[model samples]
Target: MRHVLTALCLVLLTSAPPASAQDFPSIGSQYVDFGASMAAVGQMNNVMGAAVRNRRSDRVDSPRAAATTRYRPSPTVSARVRTQFADFIARADPAHSEGLRKFVQQNDLLGAWEQHVAGDGLRRGDVADAMTAYWVQNWQIANKVAFASRAQVQSVRAQVAGALAGSPGFARLGDAARQELAETFMLNFIAQGSAFSDAAARRDAGATRRLSDAAAARFRKDMNLDLRALRLTEAGLIG
Candidate 1:
C-alpha cells in the first residue's frame, strides 16, 4: 500500500506540466541531455573535491599532506569539464550552470560523499532512491527515450564514460581505474533506468520496488571494492 501510494504520488507529480518546456527540448533524442548531464556531474565532483581540499589546507597546511590529495583534477581537465557543463546548460537551461556551480562549491558534497561511503550496505539504498527520484522527475523525457536500442545505450554509455574519465580526478588515474569506475556507474544507471521504465509501463508499484531493490543490491555488491579502490563515493556514483 505504501509503495502504491508512493508510485501514485510520483505519477501525479510527473504528469503535471513542466515549469518550462525549453529545459528538456529534444536533447533526449540522441541521449544528448544524459551525456551533458554526466559531464556536468563529473565537473561538479572535481569541484567538490577541490573545495574540500582547499578547506582542509586552510586548517592544516602541510606540503606533504596536500601532495597526497586524491581527487583534484588538473586545471586543464577542469577547463574541459567546464566546457562540457556549458554544453549541457546551453541545451537544457541557459541560466543554470553558474548558479549550480556556485551552489556545489558552497555545498557539503564532500561530507555527503563521506557519509554515503561509510554506510556499508545502506549505500545501495541511496542509489536506488536517487535513481527513482531522478526518473520520476524527468519522466516525460525519460519515458519517451526509455526503450533505447542496444547500440544507442552503448553509445551513450561510452560518451558518459569518456566524459567522466577526464574529470572527478579520474584523469590522474590509470586507464584500468578509469574503465572500472565508468563501468560501475553505467551498470547501475542503465539497470535503474530500465527497471523504472518497466515498472511504469506495467503500472506495477510492486515491480518498481522489487526491481529497484535488486538493482541497488547489485550495484552495491559489484562496485563496492572498485569505488573504495578509486576513492570515489556513492555521491559520485549516483552522479
Candidate 2:
C-alpha cells in the first residue's frame, strides 16, 4: 500500500513542477509530523511509567524527598524517539524536515527537551503538564498542515479515482458513500489514525480495541453496507 502511494507521488512529481513554497508542508508533512509526535508520546509514557514506579519504591530518604522527587527521563527512551523521528523523515518530503525540527524545538521535544521541559528531572506535575502541552501543540500543527494541503489531496484523490474507476471495491460503494470518499478520503485517513494515537497516549486500551474492531467489522451500521468488502478492496484483496 505504501509502495502504491509512493508510486503515485513519484508520478505526480514527474508530471509537474515542484509545488510552490505555499505548499511547503504538504500531505507528507502532516504524516511525518504526526508520526514524530506519536513517537514522542510513546516515549514520554515510558518515562512517566518509570517515574510512577520510582515514586512507589522505598528508595526515597524521607517524606520531603519523596514529595520533591522528579521524573528523570531515561536516556534510552530519548534516543528511541530520535531514531523513530529519523525514520519518519526518511519517508517525508525533504523540505518538511526543517519545519518539523522547528515544531519540535518549539515544543521542547527531542534535542530541545532539556531546554524547554527541564534540564533536570521534571516534577510529576510538570511532566503531566508537558505531555498535555505536547499533545495540544501537535494537534494544532497537524490540523494546520492537513488543511494547507487540501488542494494537493484533492488532486491526488482525483488521480486515484481515475486509476481505480473500474475496480470492484469502488464499484461497491453507494453514490453517497462514493461522493463522501472522494471528498474526504485522506482527511478521514488522518483523523482515524490520529484517534488510535490519542487512544494510546491516554492509555485507553478499551478505546483502542473498539477502534480496531470497527476497522475490521464486516458491516458498518452507519455506512449501512458491507464495509468488510470495501476494506478488502482497499487492501488489494479484491479488484
Candidate 3:
C-alpha cells in the first residue's frame, strides 16, 4: 500500500505541469500564520522539563510511587477507546482513513490513549466518549474543507506549497523542488497523523520510536529522501 501511494505520487509529480507561483492560490495568509503558530506550540510541548520527566519516571518505574499516584485507565479500556475512535474516524472520513489505516493500527492507538488517561486521571470510558464527541464536531468542519470537494483540497494543498516555497529557506528551490517537498510534507502528514493517534492512545516510548523508525525507512525507500532532513514537526502537516 505504501509502495502504491508512492507510485501514485511519483506519477502525479512527473505528469503534472510545472506549477508557477501564480498557479498556487492564496486560501488566506492568516491560515498560514496560524499553521506556524501551531507548529511552535507543538515544539514547546515536545521539550519536557527535567522535573516533569523525573516525576513521570517515578510514576511509571517505581511500584511504590505508582501506588500513591492517581488511578489510570487500564490497557483493556484503552484498547476499547482506540477501537471506538478508529471506528468513528473511519466512518466520518472513510476516504482519508482508507489511506491512514495502513500506517496506524488499533494497538498503536491503545498505547497512546492509555498514557493520556494516566497522565490526566481520566477514565477510559469517559475519554472514549469525549473523543467520539470531539471528532464528530470536527468532522463537520473537515467535511466542509477537504472532504467536501476535490477542488478545495487541491486549493489548500497549493496554498500550503506556495507558503513553503515563499519561505526564506525554500525560496531558492525551483517549482519541481517545491512540488517534491510539498509531496513529502503530505506523506509525512499522513504518517504523523497515524503516529500521533497511536501515541495519544498509548504512550510507550519504545513503540513510538519503532513507528518513527518504520516511517523513516519507508520515506527513504520510497522517496529517496531522508525523513530527518525534512525537519517536519508533529503538527506541521495540520496546515
Candidate 4:
C-alpha cells in the first residue's frame, strides 16, 4: 500500500527541475490587437451622433490571469481516479502489511491497487506470467476513469477496501488459481468502480448498477463474466 499515485506525482514533480511562474503569460498579445483595431475606427457613435471622449485605451484583459485548459479536470483528481490509495492500505498491522506486500509483488499491482486490494500477502499467478501485462493496463484504464471524480471513485473503492480491511484473511487458498482469480476480480472492481460514478460511462460499463442503467442488460453480461471469472478462477466469495 504505497500510495503509488502520490508517489507518481512526487516522482513527476521532483524528477523535473522547477521553473518560475512569471516566465509565462508573455503579455496579452490577443487583447492588444483587438483594442488597437477598435482605435483605428474613425467613427465614435453616441446618442446624438457626436464624438464622445473615451477612457484609457488600456481596457485590456487581465494581465495576471493566464490561459487554462479548455476542459480542465478537477484538482482533487488524484483522490478520485488515482489507484495509489496505498496510505489507507498500509495502515493495517505489520503481518497484514507483509501479506499485502507479497500481494503487490505477485500481482505487479501499482501502489494504488495495492491500496484497493488490501490483501494478506497473497502472490499473483505462477502461470500466465505474460498476460499479467493485461491486468496492469486494465488497472491504468480503471484509474483514469476514476480520476474523473475522486469523491465518486473513493466512495465505491472505499466500500470494497473497507470490506477487505474489515474482513481480512480472505485469501486462505494461496495458489496460482486463486491468484489469477483475484487479479480478475480486482481489475473488474476498478472498472466497475468508475462506471458506478460515471452516469454516461455506465452505458458500456459491463456491470449495470444503479448509476449506469442505460445499457444495464449489456453491461450486466459483462459484469457476470467478470464476476464469474473471479469466482471460478480465483475462488472469490462474492455471492
Candidate 5:
C-alpha cells in the first residue's frame, strides 16, 4: 500500500515506486560519461584499502583521507570522480570528433530545453534520463570508432587479436568477434530501451506494480555500461 502511494509521488525519470525506502538508484553516476569517474573509482577503491590498512598514498591527501576515515565515500568520491571523469574523456575523445561533437551539441540543446521547462523539473529530469541513455549509445558507437584511431584501443584490440589468433577458444572469431560484440551491444540496448519505454508508459504506481520489472531490467542494462571506462568528450559547447 505504501509502495503504491510512493510510486505516485515518484519523479518518474526511470524510478519505480519505492518498494521500500531503498532508492531505486537513478542512472545518475552510471549514465553520464564523466571523465574522472573511472579514476575516482580506482581512487576510492584505493582509499578504502588505505582506510582498512590505515595506510595512505601520496595522492590521497587531506579531506579525502579525513572523509574516508569518517566513512563518507559518497561526497568525496563523487566530487573526485566527476572531475576525473571529465578530464579522462577530454583526452580519450579529442576535439571535433563525431561522438564528442554530437554529445556536446545535444547537451547544449538539452540544457536549453531544461531551462525552458524548469518549472516542470520532474518532467525535464525524465527527459534528461532518456537523453543520457542516448548519449551512452553515442559514446559506445563513437568510442568504437575513436578506438580504431587510438593507439591504446588499438593496442588492446591487437592483444585480443593475438590472444585468439591461433587459440582453439573461439579462435575462428578473429576480427568478426569485435563486430559481433558491437551487434550484441546494439541488440541488448534495443531490448533494454523497449523495456524502459514500457516501464515509463505504465509509470504510475498502482497495486499491480506494472513496469517495475521493466524498470529493474533497464537499471541493470545501464548499470553494465562500464561507467568507469565511459568518456564524455564535449567540445566548445559544453565546456
Candidate 6:
C-alpha cells in the first residue's frame, strides 16, 4: 500500500501537465504543478527516514521539546497548496465558480482580458468561461469521487493501526515507546493522506474548511501540540 502511494505520488509529480488549454490555463497549470510537487515531497518524507526520526523524537519529556518536534510543511509549499485548493474548488463547484468569475470580473482580478492575452496568450474572459464550463462538467463526478477516496483513506489508516497494535514487534516495545510509535505512524499516515484527501475536499468550500479545522483538532488530540503554533513555526504567520 505504501509503495502504491509512493508510486502514485511519483506519477503525479512527473506526469505531463494537462494538454487541453480548456482544462487548465496558465495560472491553473502553475497551481497543479506546484501542488503535485508538494504531494511528492510529502510522500518522500513519509517513505524515507523522516517518519522514523519523528517516532524516535516523540519521546520528548518536556513541553518545549514536544513543541519543537512537530512536523511542518515548507511555507512556499503551503502557499501553493492553498492556491491549488482554491483553484480546485473553483473548478469543481458551479456556484463557487460563478462567484469567482463575478468577483474576478468585478475586481478585475487578472487586470484585463487584453493584458492576459498579451502576457500569456490567454484571455481573462476565456479563463472565466472555462472555469464555468469545467465546474458544470465536473461538479457531481468530483464530489462523488472525493467522498469515496477519503473514506478509503480512513479505512486504510484504521487497518494499519490495528495491524501495528497486534504485531509482535509492537508488543516488545515499552509502553511509552509503543505509544510514541503508534502516534508517529498515525501522524505520518494522516500527513501522507492529507496530500490527496485535502485536494479532494476542495470540491466544496465547506469540506475544505472542515478539513482544515479537523487537521487542527487532530494535531491537538494526537500530539498535544497546538496547530497554530506549528503553523507559526513553519510560516512565521501570526494569528
Model 2 regions more than 4 Å off: 1-28, 32-70, 94-127, 138-239
* TM-score (C-alpha, index-matched) for candidate 4: 0.22
Provide the TM-score for each candidate, comma-separated.
0.25, 0.26, 0.22, 0.22, 0.22, 0.23
Question: In order, what lDDT does every prediction score?
Answer: 0.31, 0.31, 0.28, 0.25, 0.28, 0.29
Any idea how many clashes model 6 has?
0
Q: Model 4, range 4-82, lDDT digits (tens) per residue?
A: 2233223222322232111111111111111112211111101101100111132321222222111222324323222
**What is candidate 3's TM-score against the reference?**
0.22
* Model 5 lDDT-worst window of ten: 64-73
**Model 2, 133-212: lDDT tens per residue?**
23222222222211212232222222222333323443454433332222122222333343444454456666655654
For model 2, the local distance difference test gives: 0.31
Candidate 6, position 1, lDDT: 20
RMSD of each: 15.8, 22.1, 21.1, 27.8, 20.5, 19.6
Q: Compared to the true structure, candidate 2 yields what TM-score?
A: 0.26
In angstroms, how far off is 27's CA in candidate 5? 19
Number of the candidate with higher TM-score, 3 or 4? 3
Task: Report the CA-based lDDT of candidate 4 relative to the real structure.
Answer: 0.25
Per-residue lDDT tens digits for candidate 5, residues 1-239, read 01111221232322222321121112111233232233322232232222323321222212211110011123343334234333433444444233332332223222322232233221122211222233333333322221111222222222222222323333233233322222222222332233333333455333123233333333234333232233333210010
Q: Where in model 4 is the C-alpha error above 4 Å?
A: 1-110, 117-174, 198-239
**Candidate 3 residue lDDT tens string, 46-154:** 2211112223111222121111111243545334433443443344345555433322341243233233223223222321222221221122122211121223222
